[model samples]
Target: MNDMKELRILADACFSAQVGQALKRFNASHPEIQAVVSIAGAKDCLQQLKTGDVYDLAILADSGVAAAMMPDHTDGYYVFAGNSMVLAYAPGKILNAKNWREKLSDPKVSISHLEPNAHSVGYAALMACMLADSVAPGMSCTLLNHPGRKVVAADAEVTDYAFAYRTECIAKKISYASLPDTMDLSNPAFNAHYSTAKHDLTGDGKNIVQASAISHAVTIPLAAKEPEAARDFIEIFLEHNFTAQGFQPRSEIVGKSPRRIHAALEVRKPPRVQSANYEDEADVHLLQRARLLHRQQPAAEAG
Candidate 1:
C-alpha cells in the first residue's frame, strides 16, 4: 500500500471532466498516487467493468443502472453526489411562457437530447418528458437526437432547446430553465412521484429504466489493482466542494445523521470539511429504496 500506484477510473461522460479535475488535484497533493481517468457513456463504463480488469473504480450518474450491473463485480458502491435535469436553450430566445412545461408543449419548438439508447441522460430526458405529459397534457414535442451532451450544447444555438444537466448549462454558459421540484429529477423526496415515469431501453418493451432522482455512485471493483488508492481518491472526492460545479452533495441528502459522530482526533483546528462515509449501512439502504424502479436482467440471463 505504501508503494507508488496508479488508480484507473472509468466515469460517466456527463460529469467526467469534473471527476478528472478532482483526481488531478488528488494526484498533485500525493505524488505517490497517480490517478488516470477515462470517460465514457454510463452503460459503456459498466460493460467494461463487466468484461475486463482494467479500471480500479467506475463512477456513474445512474445508481440504479450501476447497481443492476454490479452484482458480482464489487463489494458495493457509494452514492457520492446528485444532479438535476434542466432545459437549456440559446441565450437570445424569448421566454414568455409560464414554465418549462408550457414552453415544451409547443410543436413549433425544436429540441435535442442525447440518443436515448446510448446515454443515461438521454433516457432521463425521455422520462422527464413522460412525467411532464402526465401532469400537463400536450407536452408532445419531437426531440432532436444527439450523440452526447457536448453535441447538444454545441448545437444549442440552432436548436430551439435541449435537455441537459444543470451543471452542463452552468459550465457552458447556456441559458437554462430550472424545472419545478415535481418535474426536476433532483430531490430524493420526490422519488416516488418520479418512479411513475419510465422509459423502455429496448424497443421490445423489455429492459425499462424508470425515472428516479439523479444520484452518482462510485465503486471499487474486486479486480482493482490499487484498491487502497481508489478508496483514498474517493475520500478526497467526497470532501471537495462541487456546489459551484452544480452537484448537490450526498451529505445534504442522506449522508448526515444524528447518530454519526466525527472521528476523534486531537487537533486545535478541525478538518476543513468533515468527510462522510457514503458506504454507511443506513445510507446505502436509503439509496437502494429510492431506486426501486430499475432494469435488472434475470440471474440466468445475466450470467
Candidate 2:
C-alpha cells in the first residue's frame, strides 16, 4: 500500500463518470497509481477547492477554472474538450419536430433545468432560453421558471424535457433535440449574438453573461498532494481517452502561466476515415437526430 500513489480529482458531473471509468482503465495498466474521482456541479467542485480540500487535479468548465486562477490556486490550465447544449426528453414524451418550441411553452409540459447559479449546464440552458426568446419574445421567461432539478433526477421524475449536453444525452441514451449554433452555445461564430443574452441569478438585476461554447478545462491545483501523478494522469487522458469518448479535443492552450509538461498538448488531426467509425457513431447519430428535429422548424424553436 505504501508503494501506491494516490491521485485525487474533482470534476463536473458531465465528465466525472466517464473520466472515473477511464481512470479505472488507466489503473489497470499502471498498478502503482490509485485515482479517486468525484463528480459534482461546477460550483460544488469549485467550492470544495476553495474550502482547502486537496485534489491533485480538477476538471471543470472554463468559468470554474477562471475562478480558481484568480486566487492563484491552480498552477496551470488546459483546454481539453468541447460540448454543446441540447434539449432532452423521454422517448415519445415530446415531439422531435417543428412543434418542440411550442411543446416547451405549453403549461402542461413539465420542464426542468439545473440550477443556473451552480452549474455550467444550467447557465448554458438559461442562455439557450434567452436566445429562443429573442425570436419568440416570451420563451426565456417560461424556461427561467422551470423547476430547478438535476438532469438525472429530472429524468427519473418524468420531466417532459430539460436542457442538457448533446454528448450527455447521447451518453445516457436519451432522445434529444440538437440545438442550433445560435442557441446551443457550440458555435464560436455566434459569440457576439450569444453575449447579448444574459440572466440574473440573484434576481436582483445583476446579469451573468454566458460563454458561446462549453469547453472543458483542466488544472493542477497548487495544493495538490501528488502533483506529478496528477500531471501524468492528464497526459494519459489526453493521449488515450478524450477522442475515443466523442469529445472534440482542443489544439490550442489557454491559461495563466501554464506549467510546462512532457505531454504534447496538441493532438494531431487524423486522416479522415470514410467507413462507419464506431468512435464517432453516437455523435453522428445525435447530429442526425438534431437535424431531423430542426429541419423546416422556425429559428425560434427551443433547443
Candidate 3:
C-alpha cells in the first residue's frame, strides 16, 4: 500500500466533524493520504459494513451495536472514545423552564427517547433505571417512546423528558438537565478500526453518564481492488490529529481518561482566557450523558 493516498471514511453524522476536524491538522504532515467522508446513521454504518462499502473508518455506539464480518487477519475493533448518558430536556417539554426542580415534581414530565432500537438510546434507558433506583428507592421515571422526529407535545402543557448526549441536545437548543459528575457510568466505551487496520483514532470524552462506545466499523468489499491503499488510509486517521477542527475529544483513544475527562477538558485553555462571548462547544461537558430525541409519528388512517 502506498503511503500517499486519501482514505474514504464512513462515520455517523454525529462524528463526521470528529474525523474532519482532527484530520485537518494531520494533513499538514501526511500530505499523501486524503480523507473523504460519507456520513450516515450509526445503524447504516453497520449495513454498509455487511454490504461491503469498504470504508477506512467509522463511528458507532459502543455497546449498542453488533454485526458479523469476515475475520480479516489484519483488522479488528479498537476502543477509541466514550460518551456518557445524560438526561436532557427539550425546551418545549418543560412547562416552567425557570423552575425545573419543581417541574420534575409534577406528575406529567414527558421525557423524549429514541425507540429502544436505537442502541445508544437503549443504553441511556438502562442508566435511567440505575438513576431511579438511587433516587426514590423504587420510584421510576417513565421512559416514553417516540420516533426519531416524532413528539407528543403536551395537549395544553409541556412534557418533561430528555435523553441522549449533551452535544445533540445543545445543538438543537433543547432545555437540558444533567446529573452531577460523581454519578457518571463510564463502562461502555466506543470502538472502531479498519477491518484490516492496526489502530483507532479517538481522543476522550468530556461527557460521562452516556459514555458509551461508538464503534466505527469499516469493511473492505471482498472484491475491493485496492485493499492495500485502503488499509494505509485507515492508519493515517488513527494516528493523525484531526481534533483541531472541533472534533470532540475522546479520552480513551487520544490520551485523556477518567470519568472527569470531559469535565476537565472543558476548562478553557490559556489562549482563550476570556469567557462569556465564546462560541458554544457542542457537547462540551464530558461528565454528562446526551439526551436522545424521540417523538411519535402520527399514524395514518386506513383507506
Model 3, range 1-303, lDDT digits (tens) per residue? Answer: 666566566666555555676567556655766666776654465556666666544445442232333343112343444444455554444332223335554554554545333234443444443343222334234322222222332122333555555455444545455432222233232111011111111113211222233333333434444455555544554453323321234433222111121232232222211111223332432312231111111222322
| Model 1, residue 19: C-alpha shift (Å) | 2.1
Against the reference, the lDDT scores of all candidates come to 0.64, 0.65, 0.40
The deviation in Å at residue 298 for candidate 2 is 24
Tens digit per residue, CA lDDT, model 1, 169-234: 767776676555555688787787799887776566645678889988777777888777777777
How many angstroms is residue 197 displaced in model 3 relative to the true structure, after the best TM-score fit? 32
Q: Candidate 2 on 1-303: residue-level lDDT in tens? A: 387777898877777666766697778877777888887776677667777888988877654344445456874577767777777776567444345667776777777677776777877887788776543557677766644434444335667777877667666667776555656776565576677776554456533444556677778888888877777777666655555554555644555433456354666453322211112334544553365346425756654
User: Which stretches of candidate 2 lie above 4 Å from their native place?
Assistant: 1-4, 145-155, 197-209, 240-246, 256-303
Candidate 2 Cα RMSD (Å): 7.3
How close to the true structure is residue 224 of candidate 3, measured as C-alpha lDDT?
Answer: 42
- How many pairs of residues collide in model 3? 65
Measured by TM-score, how close is model 1 to the native structure?
Answer: 0.72
- Candidate 1 vs candidate 2: the TM-score winner is 2
| Candidates in descending lDDT order | 2, 1, 3
